[model samples]
Target: GKGSHSNDVGAIQADLPVPSDVLIYYYEVTVKDAGERGVIAVGFADVHFRLSRQPGWEPNSYGYHADDGNKFHNSGKGEEYGPPFVQGDTVGAGIHLENREIFFTKNGKKLGAAFQNVKATLFPTIGLHSQNEHVEINFGAKPFQFDIEGMIAEEREQRQLAVLRSRIPAHACHDIVCSYLKHYGYAETLLSFDQGAYTEQVAKDEETPQAFGLEDRKRVRNMLFEGDVEGVRQLLIGKQPQLAQLQEDPLAVGGSGSGHKGAPGEPFGDAFFHLSVQQFIELLRQDKIGEAVEHARSSLSTFQGRSHQHDQHLQDVLALLAYKSPGQSPVGQFMSTAQREKVADIINTAMLESSATASASGSGSGSGTSAGAGGG
Candidate 1:
């Protein structure tokens, strides 16, 4: 029930049938009578209610209520913000759904407020000032409105991408890029790929073999980090047949045979060859040398003949096998048992030292400073 108090300069009471365990009543009080007239500065003492467990009514605790209002969760405890909203030109009040954030305003303006974890309905009390000082208490019922913020950085990134698509180049290798996009789980947005003035791709001279250079390496790196592992894997699988034929009977880019017409004896860098080598190394570390060697041979068959450096690395890896432990290690097959133990000790010590250094470096690299993931 809503009520109004006129030029009365005394305490008074109004009845409300709010069986609500969580009651939020908004009030607008204009203290027109300036003659020492103070109203429900803190409306808590004036509000009253009782839970279903009780037959009779009791004073509702306004300081704080446990699950006293609506809630999607059970966050413990609630408190009022700021001092008791004693007096203002116009005072306002509101109650948050149990632990819910609430903004109360008088005449649509903000004011000091209290919060609660209110569950169930309630009939809360209100006052003009100090439990009915010669002040007016005017309150009305209203619905609560809410707003929430999301990942702004992610949203900003999406917006920027949209702007770029409107201003960049139109996709030329549209089909291939679309395939990549699908592989990466991006919607087929080839039309929106760029927004700048569109330009056609310029043809490059292909007579030179080194011309491709590290460009393919960059392409591989982008593909690897693009998070389309399955799509990339599928692409790799589809190309595997071609790669297999190329390996079975090596041919130049122009079909010059064996090595690309002018392809380097070993064009692959140590890093490039290490992916498969490390695969075998890990297997060997697991004491699966037979399986490791099998994997190594297969990888070598596919790639070694194409690169002289890869062939050399394969030899080094074979030699590394000669440095394994005494009982189960492969090194003992080629080296004496004593030599094997000595080599094992050296490798272990080096690894420990390197690990220690890396740990120290990683720890020292940060003084707790960091920015968002997309920060430049």
Candidate 2:
């Protein structure tokens, strides 16, 4: 609504304060009519801001006025800021929480920072000082005229780079990287990194007892990644004969012959399901539709109706067959290298967890021997 008189300055504040959890918060306003005084203002103000007073005329408030293009905070006096906005002009205000700075934009062009060290639980506010001061506010219901997404991305990249540049002991960093490689079964990379160690401390750390069956885990991971699902199955069975038994009697998980309280097949069932899906995907990728269908019927059909998640996954996997170019299909994400990596990561984590469980239980029955099978 338009202001009734010069002193009848009208202002409005959002019901909620600007969110501080995020890296940035911003809003924009389009001046439909600058009116008699062209004194429209857009900024932020604390809860105590008076509705009848223009924002920035009192304490704990900030504003950019239209007539003079000056910014005001905690005072009636204004400071030089950006170009004055008028009718048909779009203006924006933003708070960068990381830097504690407030800035404005005119017609989608960013103005420099207007205030520093802004520490207030402020609300998005607008002020009208005279008649016909028509304006429209956009609180991100639509695309922002400013590239706020890009700003957030840049901030995240800068923060990550800062962390990377922080000082840390070389041996400590090497050990962390080496552990990551070993955990993911990147045996070849681990070997290369070990050989490239620049100091004796790193070389000595390498001699520490590695995870059990590091080579086996690496081989299975490589085979899965290479689309050799059959090879992975064969290798697992050869290395851990118990896996063949588990496949025959899934209820025998954890080697608790009589009362195994866990889910039937437990993690092994999960691993084999993922592997079967990956095998089906690989077959489809090779355009062997008949073979893929047969494999799905033999392996995947048994997993259906087991759970909603399993049914949904099977549906998505089968959806790929309807597309001549599965890579471009809606379900194409399942065909990506990322999908294979996801399965491999899950398998690796399952193996590590099973081995850790077996070692902790101190079972002389060699339950850890089937850790790789459990992952498969």
Compare the candidates by lDDT and give the number of the best one.
Answer: 2
At residue 57, what lDDT does model 2 achieve? 84
Residue 173 of candidate 2: its Cα lDDT? 77
- For all predicted structures, in order, the TM-scores are 0.23, 0.50
lDDT of prediction 1? 0.35
Model 2 stretches astray by more than 4 angstroms: 1-6, 170-376
Q: lDDT tens string, model 2, 1-376? A: 4555645888999999999799999999999999888999899999999988878887889999999999999888999998889899999999998899999998888998998999988999999988878999999898778877657645664564344334455577788989999999999999988878737543333211212355666677778778988887776566445556555543355433425433222445567678789999999889999999998788788677767887899999999989999989999999987688778767655555554444333333333333332332
- By TM-score, who's the top model here? 2
Q: Lowest summed-lDDT stretch of 10 residues in model 2?
A: 203-212
Model 1 lDDT-worst window of ten? 367-376
| Residue 334, candidate 2: alpha-carbon lDDT | 90
Task: Report clashes for each candidate as comma-separated counts.
Answer: 31, 0
